[model samples]
Target: MFSPDALIASAKRTISLEQDAISSLLARIDDSFVRACELILNCKGRVVVVGMGKSGHIAHKIAATLASTGTPAFFVHPAEASHGDMGMITADDVVLALSNSGTTNEIVTLLPLIKRLGLTLISMTGNPDSTLANAAQVNLDTQVSKEACPLNLAPTSSTTVTLVLGDALAIALLEARGFTPEDFAFSHPGGALGRRLLLKVEHVMHSGDELPAVTRDASLRATLLEMTQKGLGMTLILAPDRTLAGIFTDGDLRRALDKGIDVREANIAELMTHGGKTARPEMLAAEALKIMEDHKISSLPVVNENNQAIGALNMHDLLRAGVM
Candidate 1:
């Protein structure tokens, strides 16, 4: 077989160089990183990210991660800042300026005004001596010895180090702010995580007259009729005070038939299972699903504190709600 050798060898070299770049990035996370974290954590306004070209793309991504993980941020292109986008940067906001060489003119072009406004600046730079780095309140060193590009010319390793440094800052601030999954859900209400976490039992559970309910003194035939009519696969046995007394399900019917009990004559109170698994109106639908799973049942009656049936839900309701 003829070997197309140079391209394959070059590919391997790119992978190795990038791996080295990432490894070098780890060693660079030191006290300066702590200063960056402190500045972001203390900021009362949004984190405004600014960069040019390839760094601009990375800056946009960093801004999105910061916003999603509970730190409010937005991306402003450095070139656009000179054309009046500079108004987006408020004095209370922290400006994250990114430049691998730390002297990108597009970013530096906005410096005089950004400084005049007295806004806090945080810079990611390979060159500590560069103007942008020297002007910032915090400097994150994203220096890499070489790039994955074989020519060592492109922004490969530098971009990776910058991205890692951005992630490090985001996660540190996220932990310090005590950002929870529920808080993230509130910000992303249209996604699956929001649907799963924020959608409550009351929003999905069957309420009012749709609930399959019967009194304990009712006949087994009447309970079975109620179950068949309501199609919940079960029926709630309620006390006189409207609290749950017991439950009658298809399982109880099968057992009663196995024991030769006459459904027409049997009292539902004697046939029903007393004090079975129940759900509350305020309980999470996901939690109710877990209880049903643990008990090997398919339905649960939601009840009040006095044990009266307030509502009922089944596995089908959960499946329809997309909680399953």
Candidate 2:
């Protein structure tokens, strides 16, 4: 078996090489990269990323980065392209070709069809003078000083350079397109970021009959009953027209008791907070959580312009809705 120290040293060598490779990637972010960004940003259709072998893996990642960052893109294997996948490319699309040697037979084989389609070509290659690079309207040089492989055969450093270059392009276009967190959330609705941005208080608030409520004239006993029945630890006080008048919480009940007010004699108005903290229905749940925190309150009453209790929501509701 290989000694553990040797393994660790070899791993360090790979990491160091890749680190240098990424650092060297900064120079590639020149006019060629800018032109590539302009092409994808102006493209009416998707970006088609094509590569062969190890370059294909990097190309796939590049495509995913592009798609998530606002430049719509997908990866296509050059081998598969020659095997009838070439039909997927069209004049409306921009083709990003990847070849470390700039001479992958599979990618070279499809150059004529790509040109015939009149598709904009962007190539990433080690040799800018090679056929693939020569064909491109823009060429990104992913050439590395050396491979990290002990035998200089594996694609460690080169792939890192290519991946970093792709990231640069993605971020440049992302900023150029003004892609915001909201836009990213729209693309990933099932993810946590989406839940935080897209989930509104109305989506999870308990409304109508489910809302725990009382009235300004209601007795303390009635308010307690409302809170107990609703199991929300609080009750909303509403007006005759069902508009929110105030809120009575367990804290208010405690305060009322401390003041020696009899629950039977006290009305909801005497023990409730008038026009307390409230939230709008369309407000983001994350924003609601901030309101709750700012107020140091556990529950919130979502109200309309009439001050009507349209909804009752608690911190637990946010947790359940994945908004917390």
Candidate 3:
């Protein structure tokens, strides 16, 4: 078996080579890259990505990234395209073709059809003078000095550079389109990121009679009863006019007990924490989570414009809603 130190050294060398390959791409982001972006930007239909072998895998990822970031794109296997999937392509669309050697037969076979259909063709290839590059309206140079594999046969450095170039294209389009977090959330509605961006405090808060609340003059024992009934680990203390006065939590109760304060006789006002952190209904649930984390609290009172407690939320609520 290979020694751990030797394995580590080999891995480091591979990473360094790939890093150099990516760094070299900085200088290659020329007018051709700009033209490719413009072609996709002006395209009326989706971007159809096609490739073969390892390049096909990279093409699939590029298509997905483009789709999620405001550009409509999908991957079609070149072999499938030659058979019948070519019907999915339209004149208004743009074709993004990838091939490391710029001579993948499957992809090369579809070039004439793509041109005949009058679709804009963009190629990402290692050889700038190859047939695919010559046929493309814009050729993105994804050339690398050498493969990171010891045998120099595997698709390592070339694939890395191609993936990075695809990312550059997707993000450039994303910024050009002014795609917002809300727009991204719509694309990833079931993920944690979507929950953080789309969920509001109002969506996860307990409202109306479910709010564990009592007037400021209520006894500490009464506040504890409300907290127990609501199971939110806290109670909101409101003033006579229904405005927020303070908050009393399980932590406060523990401290009051440690200080020998009698829960039955103590006024809730004297035992509560004054002017605690508040949440707005329209505020992002992620933002409310930040407040709770910063203050080291487990709950927050959702207040209206007049500072009246309208709802309440706890850590459990955020966890249940996948906002945590």
Candidate 4:
């Protein structure tokens, strides 16, 4: 019995309402917000986030964002805290409590004990005048004009605003700490982002015997054999003293065939590209990929400080390492 048009209309209205709620939050980033950030920034211990029901879900996400961005944080359900989880909070910790109505019984019940422990209390609530806000040292107002739900009972727009506010707080703290991409990579070492930011050419490139190389005076036939044996689509051309002279790739082979050059007799130095694009062992794998893409090449030779080819890598290596 549901109409498609009605469903689309309801979805659009919900999005629009949530957008307005977030927009309203921009003006609410007052001194209280700054105070809350300062408390968390100065805390010697971790941030302890507590909420009930829908707020608890948002609290969990906020805690994750904070932890990943250089802040130590964890979420504790308000009801669970009442049972036995209250032991998790220490005097040095900062408590970040969330309640839309600011009257969540479970959270409210913990306020007395929180005060006794001398922990810094920061509250995010939709009701500015609620008991939770009054009991906190600093209060963040996440008030929304109305719920996105037509019934006005569901925590729709209010939850969206709260989540956005939490993100804003996390980003502010991250910037305050001067968090860098490498710092982020350390926290997410198992993810694709970690590979892109942390994995270096030395970590994935073919080195030692696996690196394909041929002297500049070597015949094209021998260079092709090295390429085939290495399967890197390219071979590094080294001078007599073992320094990088040039590079020969499949593209050069194709051009040689087009010109009808004699592969058996032609020297690799004559056809090789001089001082071709190269990567450093310490360079990020993603940077090597970018260089390959910019030059429209498939392989890169990793060079040392002395300009000697120490390793080799190709697009396939990047793909296999999850750096693509």
| Most accurate candidate by TM-score | 2
TM-score of each: 0.91, 0.94, 0.89, 0.94
Candidate lDDT (C-alpha), each: 0.87, 0.90, 0.95, 0.94
Least well predicted 10-residue stretch by lDDT in candidate 4: 239-248
Query: For residues 1-324, what per-residue lDDT tens digits would candidate 4 score against the true structure?
Result: 779999999999999999999999999999999999999999999999999899999999999999999999999998888889989999999999999999999999999999999989999999999999999999999999999999999999999999999999999999999999999999999999998999999999999999999998899999999999988899999987778999998999999999999988998989999998899999999999999999888999889999988999999999999998
lDDT tens string, model 1, 1-324?
Answer: 547897788778888887888888887788888888888888899999998989999999999999999999999988888999988888899999999999999988888998899989999999988999999887888888888876889998889888988888889888999999889988898877777777667777776778888887899989999989988888889888898888998999999999999878999999899998888877777888899899899988887777768888888888887778
Judged by lDDT, which candidate is best? 3
Candidate 2: worst-modelled 10 consecutive residues by lDDT: 25-34
Comparing 2 with 3 on lDDT, the higher-scoring candidate is 3
Looking at candidate 1, the ten consecutive residues that score lowest on lDDT are 198-207
What are the per-residue Cα lDDT tens digits for candidate 2 across 1-324?
899999999899899988988888886678888788888888988999988789999999999999998888999888888888888877889999999999999999988998888889999999999999999999999998899987899998998888888888899898998999999999899999999999999999998889998778888898899899899999999999989888988898888888999878878887799888899999999999999999899999999887778998999999999987
Task: List model 3 lDDT by residue over 204-306, tens digit each.
Answer: 9999889999998899888888999999999999999889999998999999999999867999989899998999999999999999999898999999999
List candidate 1 stretches off by more than 4 Å: 1-12
